[model samples]
Target: MSALQALRTVSGKLQKTQIQVSTGLRVATASDNAAYWSIATTMRSDRRAISAANDALGVGAAKVDTAYAAMSSVVEVLSDFKAKLVAAREKGIDLDKIQNELDQLKSQVLSISQSASFNGQNWLNTDVEDIYDPDNNKSSVVGGFTRNADGTVVVNSIDYSMLQSALFNSTGGGMLQADPRDLKTIGGLRFDYGNGLMSTYSLRNTGGWGPTDFNFDFSSPITFGAGDSISFDVTADQDNPADGITPPYDAGQTTSIVIDAARVNSALGRTDGTIGTYKEYAAVLRSALVGSGLTATTYTRFEPPGQTQTWVDVPDVVGIVHNGLASKDGSSMAISNVSFNGVTQANQIAPRAVAYGTRNSEMTLDFEPFTVYADVVVSMRLRVDGSYSNLSFDKDFADLALGKDNGKVETSAEMATLLTALVNRPDVIAQASGSGTVSLKTDPLVDRKSGEKSMIGIDGISVNIEPVPTMNFLDVDVARNPEMIDGYINYIETAMGRVVSGAAALGSLQSRIELQSNFAKHAMDMIDKGVGRLVDADMEEASARLNALQTQQQLALQGLQIANSQPQPLLSLFQ
Candidate 1:
């Protein structure tokens, strides 16, 4: 080779070796090797992305751990609360003290939720933003890093919706929170008797309106003389019947007729010459008054010579014999009293006889005013205090045949039914549609875990934590009714179940985050190693190459020197 070409070749080889030895790299720039340099740069970028994803995963794991811890604390608090409730259920336990402990445990749960935060992120304490879709509360952490075929960077993440769970949701019903409850019942008749005593009487034995198959009992028969008479009067208020105030037989307008002694002994005969047969006399008197016609009002009586005596408007009666000498008492009864509507008669009437009378002889005389009729019958007047009490049937009695028909008592059965209805009316203060008796109130909670309009009375029991206008356990005097402690135990157990479910959800989410974090760490390490393989310089290999390149540079320089010396020899030849 020519000296100039040999020197130029050696100089180029020495420059290349010096550059390789100083730089300690196979491909330093794209100009050195386009394909390898581009691939190494891209892989290094991917490794950095993996590191960032791992950092995000760590942060997410911390948040999940914090939530998990808070949930665990809540579960413990609920457990303690349940224990207190169970203790309260024990016979003769201090319920107030147990309730205090339960309250404290609930406070602890709230405290834990508020304090459970890591790196300025509190999952348990805060509520999810998306209320409509609870699952939209995505608290995911990046788990993987990758490059798409289209040159887009793809990051894979692990999903965690722990905060959206029912336990931690504050806007909804959380584990630590509770709603106010009111009393509700099914199937019962509610009556406010005010301040009166409630009493029931069996009235099936009593007659409807007439002298129902009733007879007189003679303790002993009496022998009457020619100049003795027994008299009694029954008066009815045509202006006012039942005192228009109370119930039962309140809305009735009735008439009263009196049976005098002259009509009983003279008109209706005693059968025996000495008036021994009293029952037959009483029957004859009752029959005569039922068909007889007389005035309904009171007036004076006048008599004309050899003519019949006339009463203008005397208390409607049948017989009109007004002679005291012809009247006689057949039965030897001294006193006879009347009673109606749980009240006794004001006065008693005694029988009179001129002859010797046995003390035990008794007879029943039916009065016309208290007797029965085919169409219109006289009703018993109810008295309150000294005066007669009345009721306005149009305003008081409702949905009854007697009230609708305007007190025209027809049959005995109809009258009995009306009585029953009136007696039961006091028990029904209000009406609703349910089994037995049910009282309903408004919704306790508007929105909660499941949905809106959560009712207070779910089961037969009501849980009350606040003072409301209704009855509740808080207002219950446990000392008076010791059986109420058992109910609180059941409530606490139900609350514990809710807290446990929340804790379980938290644990599951925590596991997911931890697993994703572990995978992210492992994958990031692998990616770093791969990037190192693609671009990282091997120190031992580079050192060996550096020594060899240094020797090669020295040899190339010697060769260039040899080539320049040859040019010097050629100059001697030219001399």
Candidate 2:
């Protein structure tokens, strides 16, 4: 080639390399412009992140929707329960029959509670926390229930203090602590299957006690049912006699105690807790306390009414600290002002004060009735309070709580916290849906475990019966007066209505949440877009440059060829 041609070729090569290096790219600006490539890169990265965020939000929303759908079913079941109650009231037959219906309805409620868990988390089952508030003397108990996969559920809330007074208050009502003496000395305890397990606790000390080893002459776990019935006489003991449940003190002076199975297991997919069928049986508790004209320590003394009679007559009903909390005597009985059937006579209690003594053996318990309409008010869990004034009756409350629900956390927060306690604590389990499983479309909702609801309640559910059977559960015989199960249904109806009303409020809040969530997502998207715009590549610009670069390369080659022709002329001259 000619020297001039070679020089041009070398110069062109140098220019190309310099362009490539300066642009930090082999191809930039059609040939050396690298701006488009950089733009494209930035856009793609930003888009990917946005896509990921969208996916996450989408999944979350879908799960929430699923829960909502499930809750719809729960609502339906509750409606049925209410319908049944109305029908029963109209049928009006035997009070016993009505009781039976309530019993059945309660079972359904339990069934739903056990079965209503989403992804394994049970909203009805609430969790407990140790709240150490630095400010005022404030203790807290908060929790909730949610939907499940197969059936409805009764969420177990974990609010101890509130629950205690509610459950066992002869005076101040709320949740209540059971009588430890009752645990050690049960009036009627009959278990069929016998692993030969009989627990007994004593509280003779001045404070909380344990494993007092109360004697049990029970003839094994009597597997006998109706027809093959066995009549066994119940008494204090051969050794202690009617020692009056030794001082309500500590170890040497303990007052209460509790005992029950460590766990609850069922072949059915039910997460049964300590209080079995609380809906049906809650009346038994209420009847034992309230229905029986027994005033418990549920309500505070100076709060409202009748803190004297019920409290003093039954020093402790359902294991509550009735009468006065400690030393204060709120009873007007000291003035010989006690009466029965309008007979103001001196009723003397043995070895103690005389107040409604004659009515001791056979007490007259009032009946508000055990009512559970097809609805529910709330689902919650119970927690034990460590701060026991005494342990004389600790075992009773613990035993009842554990034996019934199997310690799955009580479904009523105020009731559980207000009552159950051993040391001064909140030994409550947290209820959440199975980490990833979806329930009635609700994130934190409650339904019956068996899909069955009460006659008057709204938030109850039960999946106890298998095969997802028909919703036709319990029957009611409504011929008798005072409706044997009136209180339960009534309470449920009242409670549920409130719950539903409250839920409506929550729904409003939920709408707000949705709005906020959307806003957050939009804001996040905008931020991401801005970031991407800053760094993402513009593909269209890049593509255009690539095409232009190809054309330029071709032109450069042609120019070089022409430049080489000059060298050829030089060569010819040389020739």
Candidate 3:
């Protein structure tokens, strides 16, 4: 019975070993080893999931590679475009040909953007109305899959923004189509007046027309005899209606000055009351004007005939030149109602109205290269020659000014033209130069030299636009505006830098995906090894066990047979 039981145990052991060797798993079912079987099953499932995740990473990596390639191509094309623009800057070059080359380069960029797609995904070209829409303009790629300690599975993605990566879009929001510079900080219009003529009136040098002082020249010199007196009403700050004028004009103070022999002698420090030359007459007139509480000055020196500089002392040939105070609060000054008694050539003392200075009224619209949006509105009130004109700039205004319906100002020159049209005044000349600087000046024809009324003031200058890039690469025209070549180059360089950054970003994503893929593969191997330790049979151990069990089975079977054969010896068995 013992031998029979031993044989049965060996047979069971041999069968188990054979099964282990065949299936390569010791704990193939819950009955073999419940704990190990459960753990190994779970681990095997996890390994399969990791393998799937690694495959997903490959697809993500391919997408990144496609985007990176396109970005690199874009960078190269932008470099060539910039070079073309620089070449166009040369003074006698055929800018039209260079522009044609630039157009071809742009077209190539468009082609690359449109064709840089993988699995119907194109990151470079978009058609959204607003790339700034965060939810709409964002793209993502599956980056990784993870299982938490609590047994929850999760998938993660690598996200990228198309705002900077997009090379072209239907809306003007692409890197190349959008303006790249912020011009919202540009200064408002400024008024500038040229420097006026200066004159001195006394030997004591106590009276002289300083810079910005308003002055009028006499047609010829005048000799004043005893009892000679000249008088005139001088108006200062004429634009100020508060002083005396009406609406559209500010008030200004009007005062009178009389020059006589006594005043001349007094100014000359002589008690004798003797008549004096025009120089002495001017000195006394300046003193009298000062006593009358008026801002006044006189000219003792005059510009020599046929000479620009080196003004000699006022000679008998020169007339008495009188000057008024500088304009106050942007007001003008004028002298009128003149009368001369006992003075020769008094008619030659022709006093013309003059602004405080020869400075022309100018307002500079300083604009940096910046993107102008469709909704942007530049509005301001311009005061020209005491009349106010409201000026507003927008897409509609630009379209009308350009005689086109396109809601875009194609160039800085076009912007200047639009502004000029907005002002719509022959006296106010608007000119654009060097990228986006717009200078609006009172026409030289209306300047003090031309003796025409000239004044410019800007108020409420504002634009309903944020500080953002708005320049479009396709709109660049170096042939028509060679001066803007530098601006074009700057914009292209900026776009290229962005493209390079995007490429680097894609490269980084590719590296991450590769690392994750490698990690997934390694994890799979580790999981297989761990599950093997839990449920995989060791071939060397299983083989040795099988041999030992088989040998024991044979020995037990012989022992059993021997016991069965010796059963006839009843006496020996009983003993």
Highest lDDT model number? 3
Give per-residue CA lDDT, model 3, range 213-288, as digits (tens).
4444444544446667777776654443222223454345677767766676678887666544545545655677
RMSD of 2: 26.2
lDDT of each: 0.42, 0.30, 0.65
- Which parts of model 2 are misplaced by more than 4 Å? 1-92, 126-486, 505-513, 520-532, 535-551, 572-575
| Highest TM-score scorer | 3
lDDT score of residue 62 within candidate 3: 87
Clash count, candidate 3: 17
Query: What is the C-alpha lDDT profile of model 1 across 334-387, one tens digit per residue?
Result: 112222222122222232211111211111111111111112211222221112
RMSD to the true structure for each prediction, in A, is: 24.6, 26.2, 12.5
Q: Identify the superior model by TM-score, candidate 1 or candidate 2.
A: 1
Instruction: For residues 260-301, write the lDDT of model 2, one tens digit per residue.
Output: 111111211233323233221222223233221122122214
How accurate locally is residue 168 in candidate 3, as Cα lDDT from 0 to 100? Answer: 81
Ranking 1 against 2 by lDDT, winner = 1
Candidate 1 CA-lDDT value: 0.42
Give per-candidate clash totals.
Answer: 21, 221, 17
User: In candidate 3, where is summed lDDT lowest over 10 consecutive residues?
Assistant: 196-205
Ranking by lDDT: 3, 1, 2
